[model samples]
Target: MQQPVRIAPSILSADFANLGAEVRAVDAAGADYIHIDVMDGHFVPNLTIGPMVVQALRPHSAKVFDVHLMISPVDNFVTAFAKAGADIITVHPEAGAHTHRTLQLIRSLGKKAGVALNPATPVSVLDYIMDDVDMILVMSVNPGFGGQSFINSQKDKIRAIRQRIDAVTAGTSRVIDLEVDGGINAEMAPVAISAGADVLVAGTATFQGGPEAYADNIRRLRGPLV
Candidate 1:
């Protein structure tokens, strides 16, 4: 049987002042993973959380920390995120020249390695590194900020990457997760799912009305999958 789709709620849209409480509330509401977007102003015109925030929030929930690094010079922060309790660390290949090394570093720290591809980026970049990664993040919108509209053209890209991942790990024990993020709400979710995305990341949709809304929002985004 195929694995059930996973919902990873992004904390970028959560209340920062009450992050620990927010995380706990989401976890209680059945979030599969906690998606954390770490941005550097130089990389995507925004600056957000760092290792300290992650470390402090680590004790609040048992859900996986899906740390997305939208920072250039990505290598310097790999260890910090890993040490901060990120279960899976995803990096944009465009942010650093040595993506292979970055993947290796993440794995060295005993964490799942992931690569995020922007809407304009070709899926070909993942060819050689397919076997090296644990997940492939398909950005449905540009990376810089949250709440952007979904780039509908990415449906084909998600399908192509899923095929590549399956082909590369055909004979191995490896299983790669195909994740879709940005502007993901109840409506756009099925688009990605139909195109073979297994993990959906939602920010504004997930935390919009506070913790009580999380379960309903997640249920809606999940559609019949619940």
Candidate 2:
């Protein structure tokens, strides 16, 4: 069965000048999770916030802190992010020397572990770590920058991962969320959901028009099918 649609407003597009207020507003506006994009210039093309920002924003919202770490040597910072109050820590396979060990380390810290797949990354990588992952983030756009266009080719990747997750968790109680990030707006959200994305990470779509329009943006992203 398909999971209920969840809206995770990305803080990357939030008003950085008043991030705490932005987080709080989105939380109150029906955001299911607070998505934080942590990037290192080495792993990704751009450099973004670090664990300190996450810790600072921790008190702003009580919702699940879905932290996506786009950094190399990800193992070194797992403990930091977990201690910083990240409910879910997502890392890319290319960022670590051993993705399996990385996931184990995250789960050991009592944080839900997830694997993020870049636009060009292959789904075969998940074959070894599917059971260990709590979520699978498919980057619909190239990672690093925000407000980029969605890569239509990724819909096929999303569908493949969804089928793999379903097969692995067929009859058990395992719940692995299929998340789609990048280029997600009200218009493109439904296409990703149709391809089996349960969690929608929208930066521009959710934070645009300020706080007043957040609720409506989320409702539109959730769509009538939801």
Candidate 3:
């Protein structure tokens, strides 16, 4: 049987001063994981939080830390982030030269390894590493920024990746999670989920309002049929 979709609220849009409070709110709201976007100015255009932030928030969060590393030289930092309490470390396919090795490193650290694909990146890039990963992140919009419009072209990509994962994992105990990130709001959540995304990452949708409303938005996004 297929598992129900999980909602991971990205804290990139939260008020930095009240980060711990924000995590607590999501926890109370029943968030499955706390998505942290780690951006280095080189790999992506913008820079965001890193391992230090993850470490600081660890004590406050009982949920998983789904750390999306949008940085170059991700291999050098994967262990640091994992040590800082990242439950899952998702590295971008466009981030660096060593893709498979990076995933291996994440696994060596005893954390779930995930590979993220940009909108233009083909699912074929995952051909060799699919079996090694625990999750595949499909970007619905360009990285480096939040609140961007969802790229409609991503629907087909999501479906294609889903098919690939299913085909490869058939009759095996291993299950790879299809995760959709960027521009994931209540309106678009269902479409992404319907395309076989088991995890939905939302930033603006969850942090735009106060905790109660944000939590409600999460519930609404996870509404039946999505």
Best by TM-score: 2
| lDDT value for model 3 | 0.89
- Count of backbone collisions in candidate 1: 0
**Cα lDDT tens digits for candidate 3, 91-153:** 987776889888988998899999999999987898788778999999899899999989999
Candidate numbers, best lDDT first, in rank order: 2, 1, 3
Model 1 agreement with the true structure over 1-226: per-residue lDDT tens digits: 1368899999999999999999998898888999999999998988899999999999999889999999999999999999999999999998899889999999999999999999888988886887689999999998878899999899899889878877777887778999999889889998888888899999999999978888888888888875
Q: Which stretches of candidate 3 lie over 4 Å from their true place?
A: none
Which predicted model would earn the best lDDT? 2
Ranking by TM-score: 2, 1, 3
Show pairs that collide, candidate 2. Answer: none
Q: List, residue by residue over 1-226, the lDDT tens digit for candidate 2.
A: 7778999999999999999999999999999999999999999998989889999999999999999999988999999999999999999999989999999999999999999999999999888888799999999999998999999999999999999989988999889999999899888998999899999999999988999999998999999975
- Higher-scoring candidate on lDDT, 1 or 3: 1
Q: Is candidate 1 or candidate 2 better by lDDT?
A: 2
The per-model lDDT (C-alpha) reads 0.90, 0.93, 0.89
TM-score for each of the candidates: 0.97, 0.98, 0.97
Candidate 3 pairs with clashing backbones: none
* TM-score of decoy 3: 0.97
